[model samples]
Target chain A: MGAGVTVDRLAELLVSHFGAPADRVAGGVTFEELEFDSLALVELAMVAQKEFGVEVDEQEFTPEQSVAGAARLIDSRRAAS
Target chain B: MPQAMPGFGVAVTGLGLVTPAGIGVDEVWRRVLSGEPTAAPDPALEGMPVDFSCRVPGFDPDRELGRRAAWRLDRSSQLAVVALREALRDSGLDPSTWDGARVGVVIGTALGGVQTYEAQQRELDSSGVGAVSPLLVPMSAPNMVAGYLAMECGASGPNLVTATACASGATAIGTARELLRGGRCDVVITGGVDAPITRTMIAGFTRMGALSRRTSDPRAASRPFDTARDGFVAGEGAAVLVLERNHDARVRGARVHGLISGYGASADAHHATTPDPSGAAAERAVRSALEDAGLSAHDVDHVNAHGTSTKLNDVTEARLVRGVFGDGVAVTSTKGVTGHALGAAGAIEAVCTLLALRDDVVPPTANLDSLDPEVEVDVVAKEPRPGRLRAAVSNSFGFGGQNAVLVVTRS
Candidate 1:
């Protein structure tokens, strides 16, 4: 909430940038469930950094993290900075 | 002459092209027949010694391929993917239902992902290592185009990339034919792609004096075999062909566009960038191809010469053709229209040869108002030539002394 990095926005980003199916991108959907490989996750992290202006360690962002979880992590990182 | 070479041919079922002339096979063929040059002022090559180049116009990769997929691939691979889609679609083969293991993919590229490599190197230099994408290796490697096509179509059989510099495309097709003749695969998605219009590649070619410096009139730059020809114009594009054994194609009821009756590949062991002045190795390749087809040179109605518009290549290739075909065969260099696509040139020309065979018309070489006096061949120029083009030879000679020739016959 601090950075306004909502789960909906994250989902939209995933769909747009990762070519994830629009219907498959949801708040509860995990990165693993979306078939985001390690490379894809790293790319997502870089994209997130560029779009959200937050420094999120790519390694810390695991495939098991859900869309909502990623939004929360981004919010926390934004707040910390 | 030998009656017919047993088991030395493969059926070309479908073709796709994204060249400077246009996208798709029909569009490019139309432009090539019209003898319109595709070279123009390239903003990317601005301030360089040879500033103009032939680029694939209206190629919005993000729109053609989904943004996500396009973002992950280099422009070279993107061109391959787009061309592969068209080829597969035209073949009436559905990858979703096909046996993936029975399919193969072979791609050829001289400078793979050079644009991507240059850009990523700049990023690393300016923003440090962390700014570089993890996809750099996958995007820049020469083998990745084959890998990408395999992934796209779920092809699991014998996938590899052939690099014979400018002859890479013909080499790929030749290799794919072997796979089929060897019973390794039922079908193969094979061809070449190169996006070499980047600043670094152009600068390198400029330094080598391998490119035409026709800054005043870019469109008239790629005049293969013309008396005024200097050097080749740099171009970027891709071409993919779906190949299968003739029997397999017939059994599956697939339309056979043409047959690759013979393929001959050789190396001069001569020089890195210069062809042998005598053109002996090139002649050997052509002779070998004709021998493999179990036919003599007289059977070849047309010669798709490797006329790169350069003084050396045009004269060498023209002499080779004259010695073999004796000025009786029709000769044309579609490179005049599409420019020199480097690795992709062979594949593009192969497709053009097939189209010419299919339509019984030889496309004219663009801007060849006056043939070079040293060139003693019947070079088709100005307008398309209509004839019984039952068979043709598509020649591709690359740097590093690589030579590959394919004898294509009408289906």
Candidate 2:
């Protein structure tokens, strides 16, 4: 994950991955609220890792978390690196 | 041999056909009875080893099925859905009044959505992964047709897809009949669909020497029982039948199209692609279907032969017919007119069988100029043969030595 990656960028990434309507892509919206299944989460993680070089462990993430929550975790991992 | 597992006596009330000959029951039957080969040069398949194929002419899925539904389904699934809609309408059943949960759907298909798979792969190559439609899995899965059919008819009782190569459709219908006899549902939508005219499949089948290469003469390519018969012409389409309890149909005063008195299936267990030339298992299938129907071989007046026009299938099926029904029974291969529709062959032939029983006419084997000396059976040719048909059997033998036979008696 890059330090420059922000909450809005993370939410936009998920919205694009899911083909969700742009208006529905709120940063605090949970994956479950966004109507994404486990497969969708796995795919989003795959694309995120491929693009930003950050690993998203499936066990560490939950559908309850919002896109901002995931973005913060990515920022923390990058800061540590 | 699986014994005749007849359940409560199932009756076919409606039939839907989307074939190379044409769409709808009457149109396809008329074309088939005309003894005109439906195979034509597929411009989309030009330059391929076997460019000509038997395509469902004038098929507009967007028009037949609405835009949303057509977008959500593969071509195979589209064909199934369209045929299913037609069959349900033909059956005169009020779906809104019926119990959707009690209905069942079983479809037979070999390559479910290979066409979709091919197109998506091309898209993935040209564009990025993001360009792929989210419904690809649902659209392309082999069982998706059954799933979509369930969605269409609200069939929740027992829905499944059988993939027994060429024998798939017949197997699905037989399996559905058994489920009905077992009291699984009040009605079942059963049939098969296939669209295998893609370049890769054509090339693969061509390499296996399974497709006819008589591109110059598309009309004469599928010459079943003829000495010049080389291979089967690849065809695409779907056929569906609405089957219900015979007693219930009678009580409702429904117009019974035909009675599925018997269903028999067996395996050669010999080879994967090549059938056993001895025709033992295939012979058993016919005998078992007859036994299951509670009818003797002499009762069957017409035989819808699976004469694929291939070197082995025609001769082997001819011998099987002779061995089972003796030499007097009328036999004709509808494949000679519609080409080989793969998984849907049996279901389409089943429709043809019912039509033959109703009209008392055996559709001719198209393009049979000279019957092979090796074939001793009476293969109908030239024009439709009008006869007194009390009972008929449709035989389907697939790549894995699978054999299935369905016996239908006059309604």
Candidate 3:
């Protein structure tokens, strides 16, 4: 798989960034379900970078709509690197 | 291509103001026209050399803006958001039907997010670097004001901020006016905000000889054009205006306040803090604004002067008003009442100018008991003066020798 990325790993990172219940941060969960906004997405990006050692291309990825979308963005960036 | 007309007019449909005088536009107008002092002793600065500063008293952020937003934003941004909400409501442009992609935002702030930066620094100094808020960079940047507006308004066209010290507000308005004239956007929210009554700023202005030291009598300290005037009083506030094409406002049957007919911007290249004593660049700013409005000196009847109570600013601005509009024009400086609001001064004065043109009354310069012997301009004093206002000018001169003058006409 690209960057050896997995949903389980990305979901764990999301739990800490949003302070959400660990079980709720799953591949199918959306950012809106936890009420994350643009600022939260920014913080998420920072946490993703530290956790996965990936460089996010903002132009290629905007996770304002969903958490699954954000996880995919992080994995793609990790794969690209 | 042919030479286009200088005064490409735009309609001012809505205004939102939060000043030391009051909260809304009507409240400020009534208090301003009736001649009340807004400056008072700020308890926060009780022990400082200059204990008096004009603050927007009783402004409840959590009540006005919801909890999460109010907590995340800096003080300046909170003030701007409240003002913007009012402006949008007053404009009556239903966002559901409006074209968000075509709308633009151009808000101005001098030291944006300084409050956030200072708080984070204190935490870092005490706790550790890790104690600093992760939101520090995104929250403290000056561009964040515009960025937040873009996010809130869903506006995509030319969202930006201008920072030229005190002229930031007027310059932002001028730039927005051009954006509309150039057909870059159909509508724009333009203005400035500043909540800079901090201890560091107070000490800095005092050390630089820019703030009034008359702490014993705060109300009477900001006496523009008075012989006893020493320095400008620091104030905090925000003002925003909704600008649209004249044709669009009429088609929508929106209430039109006045028309922005002209805007002139120039640099003195003389000094950083002090204005050019010769008043050459300042005069040029006035001439250019009048010319851009396609108006002659004789046609102008009212003026909203940037009459900060400082000795140099008052003298220089008075001379230029006399030289450009003549000594007969009714000149008033609301700063005498609301104090100098820095970047927000010009925007607040612009709102006052539109109100004056619409209401046919000129608000008086508070605390101006005795005009300086050397000054010759007709300073409106004590109470409101009513007349047929044909055209008017609002002047804003800031540090870095930046000057911007705006011309408003009754349409």
Best by TM-score: 1
User: Candidate 3: where are CA atoms >4 Å away?
Assistant: A1-32, A37-81, B1-4
**Range of the 10 consecutive residues with the lowest summed lDDT in candidate 1 chain B:** B1-10
User: Candidate 3 at residue B188, lDDT?
Assistant: 94
Model 3: per-residue Cα lDDT over B214-262, one tens digit each:
9889899999999999899999889999999888899989999999988
Task: Point out the higher-scoring one by lDDT: 1 or 2.
Answer: 1
| TM-score (2 decimals) of chain A in model 1 | 0.91
Tens-digit lDDT string for candidate 2 (B278-310): 999999998889888888998889999989999
Write one digit per residue (lDDT tens) for candidate 3, span A1-81.
542255667666655444566766666667667666666665555556667777654333344445556667667766667
lDDT for predicted candidate 1 compared with the true structure: 0.91
lDDT of 3 at B224: 93
Expressed as tens digits, the lDDT of each residue in B220-327 for candidate 1 is: 999999999889999999999999888888999999999998988889889988899999999999998888887798888999999999989989888889999998
Model 2 residue B204 lDDT?
Answer: 94
Residue B19, candidate 3: Cα error in Å is 1.2
Candidate 2 at residue B120, lDDT? 79
Give the 10-residue window scoring lowest on summed lDDT in candidate 3 chain B: B1-10
Give me the TM-scores for chain A across all models, comma-separated. 0.91, 0.81, 0.69
The residue ranges of model 1 lying beyond 4 angstroms of the native Cα positions read A1-12, A21-26, B1-7
Looking only at chain B, model 3 earns a TM-score of 0.98
